[model samples]
Target: MMSKENYEYAKTLYEKWGIDVEEVLGKLRNIPISIHCWQGDDIGGFEVNRQELSGGIDVTGNYPGKATTPEELRSDLEKALSLIPGQHRVNLHAIYAETDGEVVDRDEIEPKHFANWVNWAKEQGLGLDFNPTLFSHEKAEDGLTLSHPNKDIRDFWIRHTIASRKIAEYMGKELGSPTLTNVWIPDGYKDIPSDRLTPRKRLKESLDEVFSVEIDEKYNVDAVESKLFGIGSEAYVVGSHEFYMGYALKNNKLCLLDSGHYHPTEVISNKISSMLLYSDQLALHVSRPVRWDSDHVVILDDELREIGLEIVRNDAIDKVRIGLDFFDASINRVAAWTIGTRNMIKALLYAMLTPNEYLKQLQEEGNFTERLALMEELKTYPFGAIWDHYCDEMGVPVRENWLDEVKEYEETVLSKRK
Candidate 1:
């Protein structure tokens, strides 16, 4: 654990760089990272006779402690949240609906299906974000959902997206915070298609219908996510970044940029400034992709740090909505949550501690050598000590102590799930 005197000394070190450590910690506390619920259950939703992870989605391992029921999933989430500092939100997919033994099709789902989730989030004092599950269904087996050539199939997805928005609206109203309804359809072709324009055209039309019913902005805000490619949709994706960017701009909706949704060489940290130039608000699905869109656990890597810098230095924290989106069943599920969540918090703090003004002055004055030198010098600052203090203040175990708690949780709660 970090001692108060040591934290004060580290604070004074940062103070020399003209950074207010205490103020940054206060700001960090308010920025909530919406943790995905799918991570707790390995994305195996509770829908009856659920289709195999299709439409480019695949869960690699059969982890023994995977949450089998709603009770187990929420319980696991509680354990993860306990270890993580800051009041975070929960992100849910449409397939995670609780139907009370009644079969609820994707299109027929309502806010009632998620009443229990809303109540639980309320109990935790957390907000809820939502996504429409467009894959893992017979309707989407052909590697298309909203962009299907068949009008019936496309209409089915449209109805489903509309229903998801309504459900999100209900959550926002009940919780008194606007729920972000993000739409990400797995609509594309496995092989190169001759008629690419037609699919995008159909997708635009379907999205128009899905967003036609104007839900109150206070209750629900809409966002469209784009993708580079998926396992099945390798050749062409109907909802490409360009397609969604144009749609989001023209329709006055928030644009979502998943870090792992683009080419591995491309980093979303650079795109944040460009997106904010046009859109007032943007949503981010932060995940680490090792090579492809393989939602790996997030860490305090270069891109994650750059993303934090982009948001903090530009003062776009309020404009951007941060959410986690990755599932790794190869390890303890709750620990995966804790590891990723803490790293995210760490990245933000690292960025917050940077002396943005001095760095900008160096760049503006064309002192490139010193700018580079100072940048490297800033890396060695005692940000870890500050982070430990933040964890202590939030009542979470500092450093590796959280891991022991997770191991204990695995023994008590998760081990009994099976």
Candidate 2:
């Protein structure tokens, strides 16, 4: 909640930061933006009316292309990339499709085709981000049987991690950029007590495979996973603490943290500090808080605005790769993408000028009571609102109407329970 005084003070700070609100708005008038468009159901659904913002879509799901032929995937990539303005970058997630509920092996795909895809991306001058999951698949059954005493399954897991690293090497060689790989395990506890110790051991072993595999010189992989707290059989009990991704960081692997995945009570600044202590690059997933649900809403919601700003002011900003991770069902994909991107940009701009040093100084100098007062004052700071206004002025559409839609959605859910 921004107060009048806080808002005015934020305005004064913005002027000090040399941010010409009017000039930035003018530059953004025609800048391109990027989005993720892997779900086929959402492709070509909504047309972009404004041309000022442009970027390439991230392909995540199966598309019409050669599973083994990079040229075929490249062709599909070109088609999707063509839809956006040329200035944007395209991040391709998994390229191989599942067959009869099994992921096709990357080896099945010709190496020449993979090279061709990279060459084509180079020709088009588009940036590339590759997800390691491109080489593997996880079935619901796999999640259930992860702790099973089957040597064959364990071998498969090892193979999956190694193959993913190989693909990263290939992409890094072709794209001339560090290969990006995010590890999100679908494995977790279901109903009944499982051998927690065993799963942790296996996960560590699989990660060990990642560390041993030799990748290209410039390619650096970010090992990312999440924590889920909710009901039902799929509810994950062994969250981030159990896997101990910090061990990877201790051993020099990049750690990417998702904001929504933390325990509800975890402190945001503390989490950011811990991540920075171990890794060089930070990846964050932005979302609004909803009861027991990881709703990927835009960032302006009160809870997200406060915590998100604190994160930016901290030292994490320099190393952060701020990416939008939103989930949508078959409907309203375009609206989801538009709103998600818009909110991310707005939050980032606000973070760029947050009084992080001021907050830190106050905390260092004062007792607990003094620190609390400073925090309370920081929360009401009008920096976010001013940034929002700047984004609006720059023609980056802020969906005030959509905020009402979210409220309506929340109300409907509450009413249904009643």
- Among the numbered candidates, top lDDT falls to 1
Best by TM-score: 1
Instruction: Compose the digit string of candidate 2's lDDT tens values, residues 187-220.
Output: 5555645566766666666567556767655764
Give each model's whole-structure lDDT: 0.91, 0.48
Cα lDDT tens digits, model 1, 1-418, are: 5788878888999999888888999999999999999998878888976778888886666667888898888988998999988998999999999888887799999999999999999998999999999988989888889988899999899999999999999999999999999999888888898988998998999999999998999999999999999998899999999999999999999999999999889999999999999989999999999889889899889999999999988889999999999989888888889899989989889999999888999899999999999889889887888989999999999989998888887787777765
lDDT for model 2, on a 0 to 1 scale?
0.48
**Candidate 1 residue 315 C-alpha distance from true site, Å:** 0.7
Models 1 onward score TM values of: 0.99, 0.66
* Model 2 Cα shift for residue 317 (angstroms): 2.5
Q: Give residue 403's error in model 2 in angstroms.
A: 14
User: After aligning candidate 1 to the native by TM-score, how far in Å is the CA of 142 from where it should be?
Assistant: 0.4
- Candidate 1 worst ten-residue window by lDDT: 55-64
TM-score of 2: 0.66
